[model samples]
Target: MSKKPTLRDVSRVTGLSMWTVSRALGDLSGVSSDTRETVRQAAAELGYVPNRVAQELRKNTRRSVAVITASTSNYYYINMMKGIQRTLRPTGRTAVVADIAAEGVYTRELEDATVQDLIQSRAAGVIATLTLSLDSVELLEKWDIPVVFVDSDPPAEAAMVPAITMDNFAASVEVGAHLAGHGYRDWLFLAYPSRWSTRADRERGIRHASERFQANLEVIESENDVESAYATLSAHLDHGSLPRAIVAANNPMVHGALRVLHERSFAVPDQVALIGYDDFDWAPLLNPALTVLDQDSEDIGVQAAQILTRIIEDQIQSERNGRPPRPAYQPADRRRVEPRLIVRRSCGC
Candidate 1:
């Protein structure tokens, strides 16, 4: 059997010194631009893979960042992670995905276990996608590791934490406006529990907008999973009257509601209008295309990782310069993204 290619082989193939090859592959500054590309091309051709574990050991500091999220299978996190990996490339840091079961429910045991894993893995910082418990925040604070939340706002009690979020409430208002303008005054909002900060804010926005137009809007809660949401929506349709429009607070719920609508053989827009948050490619291809609120989830991820990286660098620079300990907390930083409303056949437009 052939042995796995090593850095030595890349050096030999590229006709560069071992030190030059090492620096180039590691993205260190000492290598020239031409030499770096030459070494990378050689390594690619030779099937050479760097031993990240060995590099971490030699560096004595974790060169990896942990992304704490829920529902890794969801498309939202998938696109966000793409941005994270892209931004992290130049930093020479690796991304480790840590999935938390049931992101909406913040548990102490789960927090402890997750924190332990990050400590054991020696993660330099954390990029979180859900609400964190106070204890979880404090533990990272004590360790002096930074955390940046993505797609959700930091809990009000969480001090000095930064978050990359969307203007879900304003977007919700737009959704309500379009639905109401069409003389569809009766509205139903399907959502998961309010434990998720994102859901709560989006609900708030929709509610505010609906009230302005005197629309009769009712919010219903369902389980976070698609199947559970499907069941809940199915039962609701059986006993109660269907509204003129249904606003699903998230993508999974939207899928569930759509499935129920399909099963009931209801004509979208003509019978009952449907709209949802978080657009995906399949949205346009549905029997009657779906009107969706499209936001840049990837940009959210990139911004969160960038904030954490800046914090980590600042800390390292301070230590090397023998400066006094930097404050563990600063004013909580916040950024919001605006979403574009896509008009399609589903909204009766």
Candidate 2:
């Protein structure tokens, strides 16, 4: 049986010394551009996969990042992956995504395992969302990798990691303003738990809008499930009368609202108008197209990926100089992506 090819084989095939081949593959300086390309092509043709574990053992990392999300099955997350891919593809780097369980009891165990794997694999940076636990953050800090939180706001004292998420408060305010503009005086705010930063921010924004518009805002918190939302909205519908408008917090809630509205034989806009956050793909395809605040999922992914990349790059520079990386704000840092108010037939806007 033939043995697997190594750097020595690549060097022989490219006619470069093993040291030169090593530096080229590692992207270290001193190797000429032409020589580096030759070695790279030869390694690719030989189907050589660099031993990342060995590389991390030798130093902090090479040039790879990890993106951990609750699940890749959802729409918002799927779009976020697209954005991350768009940003990293040009740089010839890879974004490794670990999907923690979407549901059920094994979530904590799966999340822990995911973080441990990333650290053990010597990932240079990590982009995580709601599923990340405090213990995972502490574990990541002990490692050399820089962690980036997405859609999950950690405490301010979390210095080793910086969080990237939507300005939920402001985003909700836009929804409030839009409804208020359309004369939605009595309204209902469908909410979820404050466990996630996005939910908290969104609640804040809705509160702000409620105050500014002086609307009678009824708040209902649910577990973010179809049945929960159905029951919550159903109570409102059955008690007396539905509000003039309903602002669903996210896509799932929006879908739930639609079910209730349909069951009651009420017409959207003509009866009770509906608006939601997270403009999903099916928004326009609904019977009367959904009016929503479009959270640019791609933008979120792209910015998060770029920040993680920059942080990894800074760490590399810092290690060479025996100091922590200089604190600098990435242009993509703390980005509040604009949510466009798509006026559809549903809102009668």
Candidate 3:
């Protein structure tokens, strides 16, 4: 039987020094990017795979999971990441933060490239706030890795991953009812691109309650950025079709909408009411204080990490018992974190 190739073999084949080869294969810095790619390609051709789990065990290093998000600027994503880290700390695991651009914000190349990088990394599992495409999820399954989604649902075919998500529909319903109770009729819903999974669920909730209260609702789509939200609503303000309330889908939109309203002389809860989805730290400090549905992002993060950790443990146990690995597909395990509505002066409560 032929012996497996070693780092020396990769070094000899690539004509790089052993130290350089080691760093490249281990995904450490100090090697030029081109050289690392060359070494990696050569190693793949040679069928030389590193024993990632054994190396981590030998070094007594905590196994790592990649925590992925679309935008770090979102308070929701940031809080979720913090929660994931807090949950992982005591379990001898750590998180590697990775960002991806999704939903046509960039070409598929950019999103696929980021997922490729995650797959190539030595992380044992993944926890993501960004939705993974079906192809990307399949790739992860082909690699026999577990993924747990936080605040985003898995693609329809990604039946194995459990999603720790908010009950956006119910929360939106609560927000709508609360606003209706305050006698708001015309409504402006501020949101990011509808491609975002959370938006659909939230809108469904709002729609249900809007019908019940006989409220008129209109939705305006903006990019997921402060400047975009401000500019989008600024244009809306110019049309003079003022809704009695502006409901932002998330905190960043809240900031942008609030700025536009304040500058345009729309008094909160008097001329126009305001509320948003996230209960960010500054929500209560605003002049009229923003009403919000607190999603408990940290807890969602913690739950996602915990689920991923269990998947990892289950895989390890299977290997120890000489059982075939867990099946790549099972019934979807869905976990929805309920959101809470907090009424503040912003909503005229």
Each model's lDDT = 0.79, 0.74, 0.77
Clash count for each candidate, listed in order shown: 0, 1, 0
Model 3 residue 158 CA deviation (Å) reads 1.9
List, residue by residue over 26-97, the lDDT tens digit for candidate 3: 665557799899999999999999778633442233288887776666788778778889988888888987
lDDT tens digits, residue span 21-119, model 2: 766787765577998899999999997777765554535444577877653444677788888888988767788777674531226778788887875
Off by over 4 Å in 1: 1-59, 102-108, 322-333
Instruction: Please tell me which predicted candidate would have the highest lDDT against the true structure.
Output: 1
Residue pairs in steric clash, candidate 1?
A: none
In the range 130-168, model 1's lDDT, one tens digit per residue, is: 887877776666545678888776668875688878888
Largest TM-score belongs to which candidate? 3
